[model samples]
Target: MSIKQFLDKILKNWPVKVTCFVMAVLIYFFHQISTIDKKTFVVPLEVKSEGAMVLSGGYERHRNVKIIVRARAEQLASVSEKDLRAYVDLSSQSSAGQHNFPVLLDLEERILLMDPLEITASPDSVPLSIEERDVKFVGIRPSVSGIPSHGYTLSKITSDPATVRVEGPRSVVSKITYMPTEEVSVQNATSDVTKKVSVLNRNSLISVGTGTFSVNARIVPQGMVKTFSDIPVSFDNLRDDLAVSGEPVFVDVIVEGELLDIEKLSADSVRGSVDCSFILTPGHYEVPVSVTVPLGLTVNSKSRETLSLDVVLKPEETLPDSSAVNDGEEKDAENTQPQEEMEAVPEDVTDIPQSDAVPEPQIQGV
Candidate 1:
């Protein structure tokens, strides 16, 4: 049939032609609504900057900063939070000086204009330090085996710090001679423990990621730790009554839970402390301890441990009274007193160009 004939037949009834057009228009509208009923839009993510480029987002808000978006109920009911993802692209981050950036949404060609094209972030840019992390896993070789003095054995000598993380000028951490552990001079070490130990090689400028921040090695109790033969516990300050104690005194050390917990089987979770300045005192005392285990590591203490600290205390009765000293002797006493010194910071520091560069990943949140 010719085109004209077909048209004439279809349009023979003016009412029917008008009705058909109206029906087709209604179907189109219904189709649009149907899409709305099944699809959802992703909420846009805004990157806000403070004074610095909070590198890779931090804290709780920054970590999940990528917006949680979905289509209106029609399209989103079937989708899940797990199905959506907002990613910040670092490809354009050429040099990393605070720059407000957006994460692009790449849709599968079938979608249309139901979503907003872009959203802005706050603070805009953050102070960034683009530098390579001097990450090194230094092995802690405990020379003393962390065992106590005579007549005792370390049933188990695990370190609260199983691993030591060091970050500094790549060159520095790489050349490190050793990762040492502060002596835990216990007469007998049994069970597990959590102790806060300062990882030595102090360089305050160098930021330690707080993991195995200290070094510790388990002692098999092979033999007596020769290192303890002469570590005279200096009693610079002690009372007369508490002075004069025994050798290798077992110090009942109490520590917080969590530190001695290392769920990992076959590994010791022994913690340590560093204090050359811990003025040797008289009797056993429980002091606030600081532990530096691996960073981002949470502990579940299974066994509690104690510290057998053998110390030497000088009582007042054993020494001559100050009044008994002649003027000349007193002058000599003043000169004999040793002056105290200040502690320095850890030396190895990560070399990220601050202010002018993108921050090296804090990984604290990572």
Candidate 2:
């Protein structure tokens, strides 16, 4: 119809037409209001390292999420966030394998008329698995256990609890053999060694290093003995311009060890020193002396007494013309010095090296 005809028809029935339009509008508005009261929960999602059994405000196992539901307000006042839970319909959809992805929300029966106001249930997922790890065992390595205590010689060392159990990945578990103990260093020791030590390893495959192991050390006995030989005298770095003035320069060979060692060693094991060349001419000289100890023996020396030397230039050799030599006395000072000397190793030291050595074992803690 043309616009004039449509207008004429509406004007002829304006009251009824307006009444119909108003009814239609009222129906649409009521339809919109009917949809408002649908009850649904929106709980906030939360995930935890292990499990999410959180405490409520009053220290209960369940927590609450504030949610806004379109349900009846009267029903809501009677309900709480804790009473309702999010219903993730995984029952129909299969994102989770055989396991159920539990809805973290506390859902109420659909018969309830309440809706959650400000609904927000946080989302969360489960761990891959919930099983505890297994335990495992491994071998042990003990060291620094060889040195002895003061006055005692270590004879032998051994581990008592040698093996430990651990658990973890199969690959890493296979690569490991033994765990090492912390380094033990005991000084001036001459006694049997013993200590409880821990193993060192950090493989998730093994857990037994968390435990303890026993270490045992053995030692031999020998009583007091003197410093076997005199101290060895060494020459410090010197200028070539200054020359030593003697042949057979002296150096003391010092030997000191466990008292028993000094007593058991022999002079043959120790010797005094003399210079390499008789050509020493002017300044200080250092001579070398060597000491020999019986097989399987260790030596230590104190600096109480060191070997000295008496040296002299040839008596017939005239003094040099230079003022450096003749400035004071006009005589050859090179002739004034004496050759080196040292007390000979006592009969005890000369024999110990050859005589039944069986020196003590070491049980050092480092």
Candidate 3:
């Protein structure tokens, strides 16, 4: 066809052609809108603080944000909360005060491939309190609960890291004197108990360099002291013919042991003895008093460490038969004269002269 004829034919439907083109563009835009899908996610919000500054006070460190993301249906299916990040930078905040920063979002490489992507967060900005960062070293205190086993007691508590470094706002860091660990149970424990425990961060504004510590609790038997009075001392290894005289020696003993063992002890339970094996002859001697107690008991002291006593040799004697002795006494009584009759004769003899009384008959025995 000729140029003049083609121009005429194209100009003839120009208005109609323009109307059809606008309608087609509208249809395509609506089709694309229908294919795009919106997904909402709850993602953690992070705060960035450069230099010597940090978020402080009631500000939440891991704040959750509700975000709506728009992309193709296939692309949105692969999108997850992990693929999105929201944060607010506090590095520009030079002074210590409350400041508002706009929350910015970042998408991962996979999510970035989706063309015509749209993202919007409910809270576009957040208010935060910025403060100068401070660090301090504080001792660690272990917290314990429950009791040890019966007849046992808690002795000492220790931690592996005696001290830890704490970092946070100047106000919060300065107020902390010591860090306390989570409660370590020693219930029914007989020996030493060691456990790994986390340090309790009571204040949300502070951060600890060491989050966990090893805590050791020492358990030992309960100890008590008891005094036993008047414990008699016995002599040991004495000769058969030797004996102890002048009253048995008694001593008071002080003993230490477990509470249960000490409670069951008495004066009779303890024995004190003096060695007499070395003493050959009987005489006064100073000897040490040795005491013996139960296996778990320890002797603290004795009222008398050494006692003075007398040792003597046993006396020997022989007795006559009782029946023979009694018979002989009875015969002597029969042959004896009355005292009154003898006295009467004596009076008569007294009247005679001493020379005549002396001339009495003398009998000689065979």
Candidate 4:
């Protein structure tokens, strides 16, 4: 056919021909898509900051992302969430305010081999607040719970590395006053309790330099106070000739010790006394009261700090009068002489009258 005739034949029924060709392309495309499969995955969204910038609050909602991939069945079987990485780059961001960043994806070499694959994410971009990085040193407070064993009490609690350094966004780091450690239980503990616990950070944006700390709890016996009343005060190191002349001194003693030890104490067990050895002569004086208690007990207080008493000499025995003894001896001698003279004339004077005989020997009787 001539060139003009050939061109005319090609142009013949151009509308119908174009329509048929479009139908065929559509049919082929539908047929190819029928064999493809789709899959969904949830993955963590990483943030990359090459400079001193970070994502502040409201970023936790965007921490994870949902990814959708379309590929042939065989290709989709080899794909997994681990093979893909999603992140937002904040390397160039330095301002301190809210910011919106586009989500980026990185596919591994093996996943990239999936030919004719389609991939898309649910959220193409996320909104985040970017702020300047900050660092602060905060004290660590240990958390303790539960009571100790019976007859025991918690004495003190201590933590090693009492302070730690925290680094995060300026806005979040500035609000934190102190860090708290995980709880440690001392239930039914007889002795000391020690543990290594983790530090808890309520804010997701904040990062701690040290993740863990050492905690030590001291447990000891419970203390109690016992009041011993009516303890009599005694004289210690006093001379035998000297005596304390005053009302009987008594004191009320207060002692403190462990519960078990204090329970065994009584009024009689506590002794109070005063030192009288310092007084050389007998006189009125104020002596300090000294108390003695059982071993392992502490004296808390005393009712009387000092005792006022009068020290005096003891009374002596009375003796007989010397003049009376001399008079008796002289009268006895005079009676003895008269009795001897009467005895010599007694036989011859027997005939005399009774009154006359007595008058003759009327000497003084001793």
Candidate 5:
């Protein structure tokens, strides 16, 4: 059959054609109505400021609004938080004060609005205090806690970015002088360490550009033992009448510290002593020796761990005896009695026995 003849045959029935056309129109309208939907969403209400300014003072909290949008069901199903944006324009508010503004909505092509969405904010209009935003560079201070392991000491603690930029409302930014990092612990740290530490947030209004910083700590081994000999040992709290003497008058002190500190030490820098305050009576004792050193130095061991002292009481004076004195005087008198002196004999002359005739021969020789 020819195309025109077939079309003429189909159009031959006017009432049937009108009914079919009306049915098709009704189906399209019903489909369109089925796809249309109304949904209520809670979205953040952001404020777009014209210049570098912030909302300060009275209202410190952020605001959110409830929006009812009319859109196709398929598009609404695929919609996300980012797709719906609500904001209050603050371009006209250039000075610091209170002001009321209208809320604006940004939507996509699929979204349709039958009527304005009703926002149940505490204040339907935006009421805020505007202030100039200020930024300042403040030093970051790190707080250290705990001690290092044995035989090790902390040498230095530092941060990579010593200072950070803080941007916030003028009042809050001016109040902040310095920023501080979270407390870092060096407990049981035997060697050098580096870590990332978060900066503490002192105030919510103030925002720090750098949230985290690097912290490094240096640990070094304590120097070798240094021995200082001949450190004079002294006694304390001894009685006046008692005398104390130790076997070793001096002691050897061993200390461990930094190399520079240990090198500056000498025998005279250390003092060793034993307390005798408890000894009321004189006797011998083995007392523990205590040593003292300069700052930045630690006492480890001593050559003479204990001191041995012989404490004795001074002797009392003896009383004079009357009979002994008299006997001494009589002896002295006997010794004073006259006595004959001995004469030397010549080498050539012969010695003769004492006799009365010898005395007469001596008178003849004279």
Candidate 6:
């Protein structure tokens, strides 16, 4: 038949043409089904704190969910794990506590176009802890560990934002004095270092509003040793009855540090003092001289670390006697004389005669 005649023959019966058109559409869809493929993906799941309460630690699950999906072979090849995600909305919740919510998937236009089937997840629900959110500003401090290099020293450490805003549960917020960052190391470092670090979480109940901070530390090489003379020393806790005096009222302090630190060294910067709380005796003793300086500065005093000071009891004032003054030299001379005079006895002795009749012994024992 001619082309025009073939078309006319096929369209002559309207019911027959309609039936053939339906069969063609069914066969096309059936062929597409035969090429369908199934895939399983581990998609990250997230929870939304849509209500007045906040999620503690901003969702604490450490694992993702497993999802099984069916799509056309060609479309399945193009899909990836990143393309699938699941989340649960907690907008309907009004109270705070633990709750189990069903996981939900957000449908993308591309995903809908693939005509996905059997869209199911292994874990359809997850548990979360919610608490009343509280926010406040707290001071932030950077914590450092480990010592610097042998020849170097750490001069100063500071943070960009001294205070940060933190939001968390009431219990956690109440106990938080300050936010601290992760430990920074200065071991073997000889120069300045600045870095951005995250604030460490004290517990699982609170979150920091300003999550990161800039910390800077200054380190320098050991400088020349400088000695400061005429630094006055003071004593404390002296006994009330004791009077203490140091041999040298002024002391000399020696400090070794960075060049800049050594340049800044002065009599005022170096504090000299002695603690006299231990001095209970009244005598001459050596007391330790304590010298204080700024950070990164070392005081060098080993053998001559002490100062000699004399601690003695205060002398009592003597009052003159009026009666003794009145007595004068006359009373003094009279008192010098003895009450009665006595004759001196000789070394050698002779025996006396009885009743003047017997002769005295000539020799006597000496």
Per-candidate local distance difference test: 0.42, 0.50, 0.87, 0.87, 0.76, 0.78
Candidate 1 residues 86-148, lDDT tens each? Answer: 455444454543444555443433233434222233323333222223556665543333444
For every candidate, C-alpha RMSD to the true structure in Å: 43.5, 32.6, 14.3, 11.3, 17.0, 18.7
- Listed per model in order, the count of residue pairs whose N, CA or C atoms clash below 3 Å is 52, 88, 0, 0, 0, 1
Q: Whose TM-score is greatest here?
A: 4
The alpha-carbon lDDT assigned to residue 63 of candidate 1 equals 37
- What TM-score would each prediction reach against the true structure? 0.28, 0.28, 0.66, 0.77, 0.49, 0.49
Error of 1 at 179 (Å): 10
Residues 199-279 of candidate 6: C-alpha lDDT, one tens digit per residue:
887665566765578898888786688878788887778888888754657777778877767887677888888888998
Cα error, residue 92 of model 5, in Å, equals: 2.5
Badly placed stretches (over 4 Å) of model 5 are 1-36, 50-52, 58-60, 109-124, 143-147, 151-155, 182-185, 197-202, 220-366
Candidate 2 lDDT over 167-272, as tens digits, reads 5434445666777787555455666567888877643223464666778766676444345434343334433444334343333345545556666677666544
Residue-wise C-alpha lDDT for candidate 3, range 1-366, written one tens digit per residue: 999999999888899988999999999999999999999999888877776888885466448788899999988998888888988888877889888788889889878778879999878888889899998899999999999998899999999888988988898888899999999999999999999998888887778875679999999999999988899889999898988888778899999999989988877889999998898989999999999999989999999988787889899878889999999999888767576466665434445566666566999999
- Candidate 2: lDDT over CA atoms? 0.50
Model 2: per-residue Cα lDDT at residue 255: 56
lDDT of 5 by residue, 34-98 (tens): 77776677888787765777766434454677676555775566666566777776667777777
Q: Which prediction has more favorable lDDT, 1 or 6?
A: 6
Off by over 4 Å in 6: 1-33, 57-62, 151-156, 188-196, 201-206, 210-212, 218-366
Off by over 4 Å in 3: 1-25, 226-255, 270-366
Q: Write the per-residue lDDT of candidate 4 for residues 242-343, one digit (tens) a residue.
A: 889978988998899998788878887789999988987799999999999889998999999988879999777799999999999999999899889877
Q: Give me the displacement of residue 6 in model 5, in angstroms.
A: 41
